[model samples]
Target: MVDVTELQRQHIEKITKEKKLITIKECSTLTGIGERKLRELVHVSGFPCIRFGKKCMIVSSLIDEWLINHIGETF
Candidate 1:
């Protein structure tokens, strides 16, 4: 399994705030990762997300950590 470096985890942890929930569009804006791609990732098992009625919400820190873990991926 891919692991997040300490530095990357620290950066991601720092972004975790009291208002931890975020919309998919906000996630895309903050990460520079498109909404469609985020949507795809959300469906993967273990990908952090909570279904709120018809909306899918995610924890900002979880997504950040996930992105860090995937940094070395190709395509």
Candidate 2:
């Protein structure tokens, strides 16, 4: 039988990688940045985050732009 579990995992991974808006945890994983630092960044002005009540989502596409804009700078 085909390994449905492995297939499902692969599918999920593909979906997450293709996602435009992702949770803080996913953003940390994708950017190799620690969750703690990411949480702080989300609160900074012009950092680019969508808030839903207490839940916060990071825009995947803006990550690169943010990094480039902050080059040679520290938060």
Candidate 3:
């Protein structure tokens, strides 16, 4: 059987290494935040983001920074 957690880690690593921007859904899944909450955070928190046409893209690096800043040593 496949280890789901490891698979998720691998996917995140791959995306980060590739410098791939992710959508709100993907970000929510990776960060365990709900879509509505993510949107509100982005709207209120001035989170780093890019909007291309109708789509919004969040950089993996920005997310990493936010995590490092917000999450304590427990992470």
lDDT of 1 by residue, 12-74 (tens): 446556448888887776677889988887887777788888799888768768777778874
What lDDT tens digits, residue by residue, belong to model 2 across residues 1-75?
899878867864674679878888877766778999999999999997899999999887787798889999888
Between 1 and 2, whose lDDT is larger?
2
Residues 26-74 of candidate 3 have per-residue lDDT tens digits of 8887788889877766654557777888677887678868866776532
For model 2, the run of ten residues with the poorest summed lDDT = 8-17
Error of 2 at 23 (Å): 0.8
Model 3 Cα RMSD, Å?
Answer: 3.9
Which portions of model 1 show Cα errors greater than 4 Å?
1-18
Query: What is candidate 2's CA lDDT for residue 15?
Result: 47
**If both were scored by TM-score, which would come out higher, candidate 1 or candidate 3?**
3
Name the top lDDT candidate: 2
The TM-score of predicted model 3 comes to 0.74
What does the lDDT read for residue 54 in candidate 2? 93
